[model samples]
Target chain A: MIKLKILLNKLTPGDTLTFFATREQVDNTCAPFSSNGYQVAWDQEAENRYLVRISK
Target chain B: MEDSANYSSTFFFCTPLSHERIIWCTECIASGAGITPEQGRIFTVFLTGDALFSFVDATSRESWNALSKVPSVQIVADGDELRLHGLCVSVARAAPGICITERGGGTLFWEQLISHLAAEWKGTKKAAFLLCHPPYMSRIPVHMLRFLSGAYAAGLSPELYAYLDGLHNIHNGQRPSEFENIGRAIATLARKSGESGKDPWFAACSRCATARGYFQMNPGTGYCEPASSIDEITIRPLKEILSRFPGFYPILSHTSGGIVNPDRSRDQDTRPRLIIFITNPPYGTEWTFGGLSLALATAMEGIPTTVVFIEHGVYSLYGTHEVPPNDKVFNVQEMVAATLDIPSLCYLVHAPSLERRGIGVEEHLIGIREVQNNDLAQILWDHDYSATRILFF
Candidate 1:
């Protein structure tokens, strides 16, 4: 939750952001962000990284 | 091979007769002269026996007649061409007044004849032309002989002709051997120009050629090499993308002699870090999967990672679409999607299929924004999330 606060302060519209979290969090976490009008993109696990592209 | 002693000009011609019999006669003539076959330059011509009578030049005609009369030789001529089947029967086809005009002396004509013969005729294998000339000489005009000799070589089949045509088109009038090395490499890769297959690197190279005009096609070599600035763009993008994530250490491992390893550094404080990998592995080689596996292992060691599998289809990820009766196709997206519920994890899936359906980076992030503002985001905010990492491949 503290990190989310920091991320919210750091993030803005049109900025590119990345995140590292377990598979479970990524799937559930994005729905709320998406319903609020932010853009999001993710790729399947390539090597060890799941790529997500976000826009607000 | 004594280099000095073997330095003699020779010519060759194709005949309907067997090459083994002609070589036997050549050895006999050499023996009769009290010398070995290697001592002098000899030109052998191959043609049918019935074609010998068309010769009108008295000297060549007489020589052909006399050679045919020899007990060891057999003459067969068809139309304007003649084949002498015996030792040293060097006449291919005889035509009356078919003289080659030269600005220089008549010796130049003989030299030209020698050059043409040596370059065009060596033997026939698999019913197709097999021309082998000394490496010291340029092997031009061999392309012409390939067509002429095709009838005796392999039934003059259309497939053979098409193969020759492809060779000609690729070379742009250059000799076949000019691109021999690269041609062999391409063949080894089981690829040809404009053909599509599972090999992403080949596809990438072809794409690079088509889009940027950076790769030059060497038909004889059966390979392509970078020729322009555009050629470097594909590799350069990876470097640029990786440079953006300063917090994540990069590690590049060289899997082959031609590829350079990228830079990777590690720091203990950045326990959760993002990593990106981008590479086009060689096609049809075992290392393609091995390379992917290694990249995966590196990511699982606590460093978040993303890999771009360029030009390859999803089939490579899961062996087949019709999953076995007992098991299901492993959906990487579903697993990553499940991670949304986890407090400490974030997952994103960017696939061409998904992108085409209007689910792209921007759209995905919008979802992230919504999730962060809702009750889920409130819950995480109340609990205080840990440090974050971002991985790109």
Candidate 2:
């Protein structure tokens, strides 16, 4: 989604952003970020929730 | 800002802006960036793919007129190509944005983009693409080939990452009747890249290849070896994709369905992560398996990815699967098992879905977390942050 891009525009390299998502959303959206040179890491926070932390 | 300094080139593909969004896009590009028409910035907009329709839309007339007032603005379209295709479209004004109506009009837009990229590159320009389908699944692969050929002809190197079923594109001995041989085409492209002195980086996901029988485990070394494939297609571990192209560069992902365009933003920090919901069992349709391949590829690429089994999708998590001996069948369960240990890949099953189907957690393979309905809803809500996306298979 472009929302991440808009948020990204506000930050610079070395900045870290963290967000929560469902398993489904994470699988669908993470590739673009990781592929684009962002460092993406995630862990299960609950039964269906995950915390996705990304760094440029 | 002088008009000369205001000149900016923005490339747009696939559908022209409608009247509603034209003002915003133009304003953002022209004035919002601290440059104005008075300062003498020439803003160029190149649009292709069904952009012809913008010419006839009644609402677009006003926007075109408004944009025309900005003397520094120049709008260019693939006018000749569209017209030759019987689109019969034209720009509303001769002044503001000139329609490229000459025979070379079609290629002129791409040439300019290529030139701009080359200038920026100061060397060879490269565009990386992700292919996610087999040869004849759809015309998307063909479309990718066409785009790549154009770029290659323009002296820009093109990179391809074949994931999921797209690994089939590199399978050796592919025979298709009366269609472009995608395998051979890619091989040819790779060869051309070498001939042109550009590094050819065409890779397929090893895990995907293994699952599809293209990579087999060697009994001696316990390492998987590429079983058979066309020349120039290198089978690498999925993780290699993350490091293949460093920094943020646009990687166009093509599936049989369509292109998954990345966010046009230049920042890597804000790119979106992906989630795929497998809501059906295997063997019914390709969605379940396709979703699995996508999940594995993304996760292996180091993207935080999750595959959730919800609704009927929970069925996929249940039971160990067995393939008949000497039968050519993809064992979905084995594929899931192989992915269980991959870092960044999580598997979840909706508890309510399993209960509704009279299935128990004990019946399913270990490692898959089971979530209740409320938790699932909350999970979806939490994921609403930023641009995180959810897809159903």
Candidate 3:
């Protein structure tokens, strides 16, 4: 799968994320407290290929 | 039944974005006038792309039914403390867990919300069918709905993981999801029939209704008989049910919430992690020896031992208050030292329980990892798949 590292400083709280058109084409959603990906408050892996999370 | 004073209650503006949505309140302050949406006097909960579920939890049945039918994002003025039950969550939010005790409009824990905006993965026929005519539950079961709701609220698909992490510890080994099913059954039956059971979910409930022992306890005594009550279905937290009838409990497996146990690969390794969870304190009698000897035996067998202290078990790691004792049972410190002296053996203490009991990490024997209660599942589940056998004391 295509993996991308996000800088915490650039991201804002309450921002939703949807990763489409990458090599994997899977949704990468992450929200709540992203302790720079340290403490995962919300990480939902949907049955459909995408990892359900906030994509902005 | 109509009181003008009652109209002025806390209306929770539930939404997916708490920080951003609060800006709407700021807009109201800026305009100095009540800005009305199409629904008029409504709470707009902004959606985070493709949400799949939403529900309402109110104190009054009338308020519940009214809000349940409202298809719009806005919740019309209802009664006091009308909670806008949207999946209010932020990924990577740096808050140390939701303040569970906080109860007010626009404020709720993540797990308490479910997804209702399913726009992306609605390609399948089954997915589309389920999304249409979503069941508007009048009553929300807090414990039953926590995990699934939290999963969806945090923008995760609940279908992938049908399990509530920490609740299984109380249900005689039954998963929290299982307990939630029973609660949902009561909720469903209540929605279907006006009569619903209003007590602890079930007293000694059989794992299944038609078939017995859906949740088996012991070899012979497996079936749990229902309580002699009047209602068709009842609801209560699994934790509450466990406390009310302090009897046998399901052998709950832990998994630090959604994060799976990390000990599976250790199966091929030479040593296995032997986790000893002790809930009872040492009474200085033969009672303490059961766990003590069991721990000693495993360590003697050369298995990598990791003793976990929880509840009253924190006392297991506590230092003596008085002078040195002459009793043989007090050999706890000595035996623990010997066990720890082994290269692989170690100990873990639940930090919350330790703090509750007023036991400091320094007060105990040197060299033990003090972790949060969330780590219990990972610590236990890791060993569960491996060769190490867990013994409770």
Query: What TM-score would candidate 3 get against the native?
Result: 0.28
**How well docked is model 1, in DockQ terms?**
0.03
lDDT of 3 by residue, A1-55 (tens): 1012223223466565444221112211132123223233333354333333432
| Cand. 2 Cα-lDDT | 0.60
State the lDDT of candidate 1 residue by residue for B1-393, as single tens digits. Answer: 221122111212331222222332333332222223443323223232222332343434554454444342333322222222232133333332233223332133333432333233222111112111111132222222323222222322111111111222222222445443322332332232114322212112122133344446456654445453222112221122222222221111111000001111122333323322222222333233323332333332323443332222222332212335775333322222223343423332224423333433332232332111122212211221111221111
State how far residue B58 of model 3 sits from its true place (Å): 18
Per-residue C-alpha lDDT of model 2 across residues B302-365, encoded as one tens digit per residue: 6667787866777776666777899775677667765565567788877766777888643547
Can you list each candidate's DockQ?
A: 0.03, 0.03, 0.01
Fnat across every predicted model, in order:
0.00, 0.00, 0.00
Candidate 3 per-residue lDDT, tens place, B70-122, comes to: 33223322111222323233211221121222343322432222222221111
TM-score of 2: 0.47
Select the stronger candidate by lDDT from 2 and 3. 2
| lDDT, residue B250, candidate 3 | 11
- What order do you get sorting by TM-score, best first? 2, 3, 1
